[model samples]
Target: MARNISLNFRVVEGRDLPAKDVSGNSDPYCIVKVDHEVVARTATVWRNLNPFWGEEFTLHLPLDFHHLAFYVLDEDTIGHDDIIGKISLSKETIAAASPRGIDSWLNLSHVDPDEEVQGEIHLDVKLWTEAQGPRLRCHIIEARDLAPRDLSGTSDPFARIFWGSQSLDTVTIKKTRFPHWDEVLELHGEEGPLRVEVWDWDMVGKNDFLGMVEFPPDVLLQCPPSGWFRLLPFASAEEDAGGKLGALRLKVRLAEERILPSVYYQPLIDLLVESVLSPAQDDTVTPLAMLDEVSSGESRQDIATQLVKIFLGRGLAVPLLDYLNLREVSRTNEETKADRSGLAVVGRTHLRQDLDLGVLGYKSSSHVTQGFSKLAWCEQSVGAGPGQVRTSIPVCRICAVERVDENAFQQPHMMQVITKNRDGQLDTMYIQCKNVNELNQWLSAIRKASVCNEGMLPSCHPGAFRGNRWTCCLQQDRTVQGCSRTHSAVTLGDWSDPLDPDTEAQMVYQQLLLGRDKLRKKYIEFSEEKIKLEQEVMKGQSCLEEERSGVPEQERPPTATAAAHLLAVLEDLEQAHKTFEQQEKEQVARGSLHS
Candidate 1:
């Protein structure tokens, strides 16, 4: 038979009138767990802080849970150790609460306190024991005056700041070592995530490191060369060798960029109500190693596997087995929104969450985003065409005559339409609403109002596409990989030479010619600078490869920072040349087939 645990409680300051006569409560309760497995709990009804006014309580459980997993609670909630904290009795500590029985640990019923008696209180839980591993404890050590105190850690970069609400014309600054995470520190988030760091201040002072979340580059072009991606370190653990944890001290101020997704691909589904999203400040967040290999020629599967090994060996990642509660947040909100709790589907839920850009279609060695080619077309004349003249008008009228298939929005009832300029015509966007009311709302909250990319409304009709008007198509911007951006279709137009066999080819030629001069210059400069790096790798390989040949390449491939990266670089350049060759071969086959 299995044994169960019981909790004993007594209020110190707060009234503890025997809430439930649990003299015989036999539910084998656990304080914290990683998942189904309990990691830490009390062996006996051990005394601890009370859930009320810092009283004392005792709980009993099998002691096997002392050092296997951690605890996780809802954003402000805690485990059964307190009145407000609740979980499945076996969840990890992805979300932590203030210390036990503190004033900040309150029930949601008191979200707005009327007076002292009616005041709100926060609940908290405690892990019986902490592991002796290198846990990069990113203690959000400071924030606005509303910032909750009472958070306690063995080490800290704990600092504080205050963002008074609006109408307060003057902003007052406060500095102090927050005593603990004892109080509910988060409030008035529309102001900002009270800035805090989780690193040693001394290191930051040494390097003069004023930082934001060290994110992957925000706006990389699709299929950007691997060499372009590099890590930006906010803090490093090497700076604080004496401490068990490195504090990446963070600072927060209202900035427009904060609201935008770290990358355009990661969209915001929703915020945790009153909870503000503070940036993560960790010395360990700096890329431990870029998993990119020397060659893009290797299959992505092999590359990812190799990179995983490299990242683990280099300390960028612990084994996927190390961390519990490994989750995968998706790119699309619709799919995730349907679930009561979000799920990381597909390979998205790997234990190693933070690695090379796996989320935003930016795998170090993958071309998933650039899998399809990008082409340009023009939007010609408008009005119903032959395709629509005979069928339901839902068909794109303009696309029927001009090139419409390319513009997914050429369908009738398009909510929005954009016509691109060819010979310097003013760009235009037409939007429709069921009624004026919705239109007003859209215009009032039109988040993306302006445009700079004028490439629009071109169709591919052998001849009539550039006639007069254009059409556009619309597609939801939900990315296949858990993203939240939206996508739309457009059409474009340009002059054509009826006598010539090809119109697109001619336009492409002219555009390429016009841009070729600048491109050629840029290419030369890039090559001049790049060759030195490539040469060094080749030089090293010359020495290394000759001496060691029996070893398979993957086992002892070129160094990530040295000759190996050049393989990717050289291959990218070669890929372009190969594409042109493939095109030429296809053209030859067409002529032969016709002949």
Candidate 2:
């Protein structure tokens, strides 16, 4: 089974933050992390004890994640950023919240050094009944991809194995993330679970704890445990202060999933494939039609994901998706003509809108822009004035279009369109939207319209130019280089990544193999009969091939032609695999040389 979580959250604001700068204020920014991986970062709010960000993000993560952390840091241009504090929400705590999700101010807490460990260790263990007593043997083979502890980006790692009160240590490997220690330690009649802890050796003070793994004595006795185990920090109580350090206003929501075995999904996969290969009539019953009738919205999404993977494994995803999308489009056309027509109009308008020259009119622009003008259109040159009929700015003169942080516009949702005016000076217009969705749509549409414009901006400020400094980077000059890279105008693509049929099929096959025992129980009665039939078929094929061996090559049966074609396909597959192996070796060699 596989578990998934859909997370939606906003870093609204921070209050009562401790000052990290000498001027009595800090340039604060928020970094959101899901289980050690940084997912998003908010623009820095310069020189503010209390700052409002109002940035939102949506992330899909594995449900097995340990926690979500929001780290507030003071940005500095000259040195590394200072850590203000963090808010850690564990999986259990988030799940216990209301289904509508958490919407409140969360107090920040100090980070503990012991909670920062990461990486994994590989171990092999076995138990034997000796003349004296039952002896346990531990093989500390190696550890790879260990987290760096030193400033030089490497750690001197060593492992200590404990069985009851007795412990053994391995020789430390210096200045490398990948460490190998092919040493075995023997323990006589250990009474408790075996614990293996990997630590980083320090020349001064005590060694730092990297990560640890444990195996029960019962498990070791039953069957020797041998594999790479993910390292985890020692469990400790989280320390959270009640609004002393600071508090952050946040809203978060999660979605979860549980996947079943592949053997159980085979029937559904077969039906879906059959529907695509031999499409049924519109009125006929099909697997997709039945699923639509029965499954909930969330279930449908999960099922669709699985179906896509299954078809991709079979190298039929494109046709299957086209078949399903065509059916859905027809259904929509039959059900609501008005809504379909409206969507068609919107799409056509977007497609016709030229990048170099186009007109965009919105009613809500009157309050957002400088004047009472409600229309923005391209002109031969910038010509807008106080008495102008409409706000005309040349699309070719547009420099940048970027999201406006809440601190800049003092509004919940806004974006800035920077262009050159009639005076040949940079002019900015802020556009407000009712909601985040509308803001994204308008931003995407405007970006699409002005993508091909010449002299486009390479970077843009995400924060306001206020108080004689850029809010994000604290640059004194108004036209100083942007602190953040500007995003490309191209929209995100569909989720069909490059196909790897072998990998996809292997994943499906592995899932089925994991439940092989259950499959055996279900099909045990037919096993002998199936094997007998297979043997008889193989015998008959061999006899027929022998009889056909004397036939002339030109007079050979169609089976011979089919066999030759299959052989050619096998040869091509072998060649492809060899080419891939060679490429992988070259890449590894290059990486080693670079290191």
Candidate 3:
């Protein structure tokens, strides 16, 4: 029995807004929806405060989607798509229900959060960083120690383990975010006694997973998943942070779930065959004595061949091409034409090694004329003319016997084509060929011609997954014309930093508009209040002067430049009030983004 490797994705959003960093308490962690049901939500542990408790919800996803939107009042906020700040997706596949481990799958780059850094200044203070190092490093600088972060993510170098876990035989590095990092766990034995190694953690070939672990017999028996982990190995004092106070307790969580994300799989057996058989070979024969055996969960063809291989004879045989290597060209059960050019099939696919194609195709050399066990064909021939050459006959599969009713869909007996210009004398000549590549290339050119030269709804052809990035085109009747391709702009990964000149400019422009609007409202309210206050002050001055001078009291100075100076002072106060109002509004908006 083979081990099954797997992945499961977990997402955490800052729901309560107290929702702290992913490693700590208060994280709004939620389990992925399985079969359209929200069975469980992840546990939130705080980094600053180490309180662990279950985060309950009266409102769930979709059900409380509106509530979530309300909290997300500012879409322009920072960390909108964070590992914890937002809800992304996960992709994981477990072949066996019994909990067996998997050997390997594709797309395993285990560094998303590792590619970036996360930080905050304060609820009211100022601090900024553009965490950009390699995949697995972090950067931290003591506050008030430098200028704000510049364009680059380089500054104080730092290190962080996104996730960590402890296991039986060996610990592992893991993540639960989907469409996120891809990681692997490998186990190789030592000295045939007790040497076990599980490497390939990052898929960067860093051997992030490569290590020697001495474990019990059962521990190294199988491979592990990405979620497995352990604490950092005890380092000597020299390697420590060397803190005067001591190491701070930074909250952490070892993810227990995994996600499949967007996985592209072909057939496993196909890969195995590719590894074993040489493309240069003609006969389906394998030599064992020349084969070096390694335990990579690899298998071969015949018992005789296996015996030869194990016994040091030239007999390493695996018939990968005979089975999984074969491809069905059309719905008619027509096998692909043998490529004398011998091009290797590219892309991801899967192969069921347990099934035999000889049984499925019902192919037999003895009945080559009547292939497919109970199948027959029809034929027709044509005559020759001045510019034409004739063939004896055309052959087609007419009927098939066994499982013909079982598998109903079949390709047409033959593909049809119509040629507009047979002379091939045009500058732009379109020719149809039996080759899939040629056909695809021809379609590609036509598409380019259509999008570039002529304007069409949605631009390129309706069903193409990708367009001619180099050129676009159009066609009228049979002739075609084209132009260069164009693309839309793409922004940077993070929008939090004000270092972006455009972003800064936009902010300033918006702030100015907001300030102007607010001051307009305040100006009216302040004017009436100021006038009334001045009247009272003037009356007091009048009474005081009248009582003192015996000459008309108004004639006394009433203080120098009385009304004008008073009004000017009042205006200054009003301006100050407006400034405070604008700052408060901006602060409220900014707090929501990071808080």
Candidate 4:
């Protein structure tokens, strides 16, 4: 089976980096490599002890990968970019973690002790959007005690910023132990996070990490504060406050619009369904594979479950199952062949047993046979041995078949087969089997024969098999010929009919209805929030109008200030109302969609 491999790499910000340049702060950027192949590179944040790089990448790889490595390097104008430090994760280590993928502060490991790579990189990663539509703004102000990689002790440094796949770089500052970029990067997207990194400028090799940092949408939106944040070591290490390692001063904020409607999910699901219908030649490109890549944390499973529901909604569950089953079959070719061979051997063994006529059913007089039994059924319709009688019942006439239980004076395995005659009259006969398993096989064969012949058998009433004659059949008019057949001397057993797909599908559909309740709750909450926001907006507008009208009698400047405040409040209320309305509309659409 092709295992789905989801890899998410978020290069947030690094801080408290060791100085690599002889001049000053080392210019630093991150290099991400899968196995031995380089996949991504972060722009350098220069001349600062603490740098922030808010970059993220999601990759869909096969299970064949070996290792994932992250390298931090310092850029020098004259020499090759020097590797500050590197950290790596083996495939086994990653696979052992959660299927949702790991998100934590992994300490950067170094290859050489002489090269000190000190700092912690912070990242914020999760699945889906944090808001409907959000704008992220990051301010890069200054850095202290940056790793210096230059020969002159003072190093030229620059800063780089990343969000999603896009990247931006700051102009280089020459010969500065402390460089202030005071740069701001603005981005708009379905809410996520921003990555920022600082690196010392190198005309020759590579820019190295001074520091790095990351701001997730939620954090930025909730804590819109500007201050100096302490830069920690790149790799896990002991702490030092105001010594060699320093801090970074910057600001970040996130602005988001109202939530989008759930109706928007239809297109996404349609795309996924389309993928299943026509799977990609490359497993990595399949919709499910992409889904695994884009989603992270708890939302990944929710998204997958919702997609399944969507597939069911479109009446494609069976096809999807077949597609998945095909994949499974392809993966187990050798096992399937072995199973086929095993089945053939078992089939031949059973075939020999079936030809042996070890038992027979016959009618007896006074519950006891004379010397010869009447109305006998045998494997050979004609006399197979001396004094053996032919069976009048034909296998083609058999209709319904069932397994019967064993009781006192009866064998443990027994079955009953019902057959119809040319005149529409039906006869039921009981037969014994070697065991329960053989009984089930006999019952199946009889039922199949009935279907092949398209014969309709008479319904057997509860009292139909009383003693030697069918009591229910005898209850009819005297003109009717009641069936004169002996009931099997065995107790009836219990067996369920074969499964019906339509009925089973309905049962599954009922189980999925639970998700609807959650959606309805969300809808109600969104509607209430929308109403509250609208009311607030109205009240703010009314207050503004009242203040304007009273401006003539009050201090003009104070009235203006009060009016401005009301306007601002109304604006905020309007924005909030818009967001809630969007959410409510989506909820309603989703509720109606399945219905």
Candidate 5:
């Protein structure tokens, strides 16, 4: 499937740039290149060695892009621009960072010695694609003198073709001055400017730029135009500053064109989301791999962050993050064979709990533990206690945790932990912490952990335990086996262990998005109710006014006492309706803020 991804690059700032002009300063601007094609340029920052240009760009490309190049150039009005320095990062290097992406200051390298410029550029790269349809076939036949950019006197050459947002790459020929690649690559998207770039591949550092050619789609509409197209030097500061660069001999031509409808691409998007929600076991063909390859310049975190936002808007953030966390856990498991808990225990404290109606006042709590995977406690007698152990809870089994009023106990730090027991009964445990801070900490931890456990599969069923051993692994009786796992029924929540503020915020954000529609519906229903009740109240007031005006009434009550009672009831209802309307308006405001 054609990958849907974008590269978000920010040319944030520059530092310690050498002077390219006579005034001891150079006006620096950034030019970003994918392969040999210039994709973005920043506005010039004049008269400063340290230039701060917070320029950002978003570009869509095929997964075949080799390297991203950033060139810092000094603008010259009278002639060509001056080269300061350049830095290039490969897709593999960026992909290692993935999802969160990269933000760092890279020491600028790859400067022509004769140009006399040096500096570092602060850049941020993120992988993302918001939201393609035709197959354009191209054949790369051969190339020549792709510049000896390597110190080895020969170049490993490759060719890349770009058409609008889509791109294709030919196989690389090793150690050849004139490499031949008789390969055909097919791209999907609307037709636009067809760009071809030749480059010398390097195992390390920046790849050498050979040359590039551009042809309009009109050039391809004809019979596959085949011939040697002379490669041109990249439009760089070196070229502008009266420096000569070599070119390449290249032969490529369009082969065929097949336009596809929009519906044809829907499956790709569906697969992309599906892959994120439930990643494929095979990493090579996974949607995440495809996305990473296309936006190799972007970090995987960028993609995940984008996916999180998208899912949050769609009210699927909880499920989305859960899947991602599981994928992460599975990947970690594969990499390291060490035996460690998947869920990290977060906090432990001494507290008091409500045991039962049989026990009187609060007793000294033994050990109260809170973790991403579960919660557990031990209790003792009022003095140096008896350390009786209570049942440990799997975090997933928890439904709620709330603050409670300290009445009889008079403990300032009081809260309740609610979970389901083995019998599927609501188990509420009232706990009193040492202080308010401790109470808040435990409350937040329990709440965050519960949210993390939202979509996790039970590690093993509650009934998986047959005496001391788990029967689920035997798989002898399908009716009795509740899950695939044979052990660790409550250990499933380790994937999202050690909850932090960011995770907390995400849960809140998801709730707001989830409640958005409900809030709107609620506001409409309340408004309608209030309007109806007000109308009735107004009609009653109209009837009272008519009776007081001494007008003839239809079937009037015989006594003034009944009329007085009716007016009083109408007044009471009007006041009650006004109060209810005020409360509804306040609720709507809160919903708006949350949303």
Candidate 6:
């Protein structure tokens, strides 16, 4: 199965970048990479310690990619660009964020060459006890896509295998990233885990470490393991810059899956239909229920996804989900109901404080009083002996509230709230808070109050409109669309997305295969009944297939056709399984061969 991920992110700004030029500032830019391949680059900002790009990109990436990286570099006209620092987000880290994703300032870490390695190596290993004693054999097949170590951008790579105090080295393959060195090394009476390390064989100075892989002694107990194992850097202390190198403000979100077209899923769909339509002798002993019972919590989610897709393909998804939800709601106890009611009341009161006529006081250099229904501010007169004048605007008229750049507004902890008056004119309010936390609270409260108002602003400038241009995006027109994505818009449609049945079904099938032996052992006493059930199911499936094959496609009976489809799907699945098994055998044979 093929997997994909859609990544959307914005490189908002960089702060406190180190000086790389003699003029006391760095001309900085960012390069984005998926795995080791560069995907995007931002334009350089000249002569500034702090730079704002406000650049956003949406990329489609393979799910197997190891990491996403941002390398910050300082541009120099005289020599090569200086590497400032880098930020690397691993696949596991990004996936943990899930539906909400990450939005924060990430500190950059200094790069180390020996710690930055990529690629995989193929190996075959076997251990057995002979009349003489115990013996071990390891076949190092080949390595591919190792990191470039030489200045010419290619490494002379070789593998070193270690068992206990003894070690063996393979012949070096020079001047190539992908090296094919087929060699087998044997060890006798060695009683430790096997370790394999790949290195760049440089004649001058010491050989550079590429990557390494290790296998426990227990692995030899199974059939000789053979496959491509990913290379990893030597374990070291965690890299930290302590915010001195600089920080990148980034917003990243991962899209879970990219589904194929409906045609590609027809076979899986047929199998699901057959499972649903087949008659069962026992109501509680259906295939799905049995699978669910044996499945782990994670695998159960995969099964549920498949079932949802199958129902959606048949146009019954909404009704099925609604029925399930209704059942859950009916099962809720009185205590749960009371808890939910209390939460709802709290939510209502929170909104009421924003929409009612309650007066709230905000202290600044000047005394400011605000009412919930309308914002009212009283400015104390300085020379005119404390004369007070009040100005008010309805809270419902507010559309957008966004953080202002401290440099642009020349004030710390400032926010801008935009509103539309009854005359259709735009009004701007600049509010200064005591601190960042207060500014955030006011922004949240104002946004929640006018969330349902008509004609709410879709986007607003994070930077002020000055010198006939927007500061953040440098757009000359003040009315141009906002450069940054808005966070206030909420949609419920994503909760109804259809899942891929093929991936889910494969996961469930693999789990069942793994547990087959245990299941057989558990029901050993019921072998006769199990055999009888299997024979009946196979006989019925064969008869249905033969009956359908004998009839014309147009004249086939509609009542029992699902059985025929199921048989065909089963045949296809069996062929696919055979093909995979054959491929694995071939790989193992190739890995075991000596050059």
For 1-595, candidate 5 gives per-residue lDDT tens digits of 1122346567778777778889988888877666544445678888988888776555434565556778788899997687776776667766666655667766665465322211111111111122345456667766543445544445677888888887777877775445657677666656676777777787898877777777776666643446666566555543322211111111111111121223432343354456556665654234433333333232333334444333433345345545545544565664432522111100000011111210111122231122234555553312234555464667778766654433213344555555776786655566656554345445544654575444332322221223353221223343442322111111111111223323222322233233333332332232323354346547775433433333223333222222322233334434544565677689899999986
Best by TM-score: 2
For residues 1-595, write the lDDT of model 6, one tens digit per residue.
Answer: 3444667778999999999998899999998776664556788999998999998765545556688898899988885789999999988888799767889999989988887888778899988888777788989987765777875556789999998898999998776566668899898876778889999998889999999998887876665669888899888874759888999999887865424334445665544444445524332233333344344554454455446544543555334444333323543677645533221233233323322423234222211112134555654322235565455657778777776655455565677778897899777666666654345445545554455678787666656678897655445788876543333421111101222344444543455555444333333222324354356547775433343354454543332233334334445555666765677679889988931
lDDT of 4 by residue, 1-595 (tens): 0122446666776667678888678888777766434456777888865668777654445455566777777777895787665666767766666444555544444544223322222223223333655555666665544445665544576767777776778777775544556677666674556666777777787666566666676666666536654332254543223323322221111111232233433333444566578875644344344333333333433343334334443556455555544444454557544533221233233323322321122332212111112233563111123443345556556655654323211344555666777887777666556544345444443443244356443333322343453332223333343222222211111111111122222222222233333322332232323354346547775433333342343333322332233233334444544666777789899999965
Q: Can you write out model 3's per-residue Cα lDDT over 1-595, one digit (the tens) per residue?
A: 0111112222212222333434433323233222222223434333423222333222111111110100111111255322322221222322232233222211111222221222111001111223431111111111111111222211221112221231222232231000011222222222122322333234333433222223232332333211222212122221221221111111111111111111111121122234345432322211111111111112222121222212111122233323224321211332324321121121101112212232122223332222121211122211112343221111121110000000011111111111122343222111223332223222322222122222222211101111232111112223222111121111111111111222222222222233433332233233334354346547775322222223332442322112222223234434544565677679899999975
Report lDDT (CA) for all predictions.
Answer: 0.23, 0.61, 0.23, 0.46, 0.47, 0.62
* TM-score attained by model 3: 0.15
Per-candidate clash tally: 72, 0, 63, 76, 11, 0
TM-score of each: 0.16, 0.47, 0.15, 0.25, 0.26, 0.45
lDDT of 5 at 491: 14
Stretches of candidate 3 above 4 Å error?
1-292, 298-478, 483-595
Model 6 CA deviation exceeding 4 Å by range: 1-4, 258-595
**Candidate 4 TM-score to native:** 0.25
Taking all chains together, the TM-score of candidate 5 against the true structure is: 0.26
Off by over 4 Å in 2: 1-4, 257-595
| lDDT per residue (tens digit) for residues 1-595 in model 2 | 3333557788999999999999999999998776664556788999999999999876545445778899999999996799988998987878888467889998999877667776567789988887887788999987755666776556788999898888999998776555668889888865789899999999998988888888887788887889877788887787777777799999987655333334434543555566678766651245344333333433344344444545644656456656655555666554544433332232222323311122223332422212212236332221233332335555567778877655453454667788876687787766565554555545654564466667778877766677896544445789876645465422211112112223233333333334333332222222323354346447775322222232343543333322222223333434544565677689899999986
Candidate 2 lDDT (Cα, 0 to 1): 0.61
The clash number for model 2 is 0
Candidate 1 on 1-595: residue-level lDDT in tens? 1122222222222111112213422112122222122223322222211221222222222322221121111111233332212222111221121112112111111111111010011122111122542111122322211211112211122323232332111121112111123333333323222222222233223311112222121211122122111112233221212222111111111101111112211111011000112211321111111111111322233223323322232232333222212222222366634531211221123323434323222121222121111111122224433222211111111111211121223332223332333454333233333332233222221211111233323322111112232111011222111111122111111011011112222222222333333332332233323454345546765422322232333543223222222222233333544565677689899999986
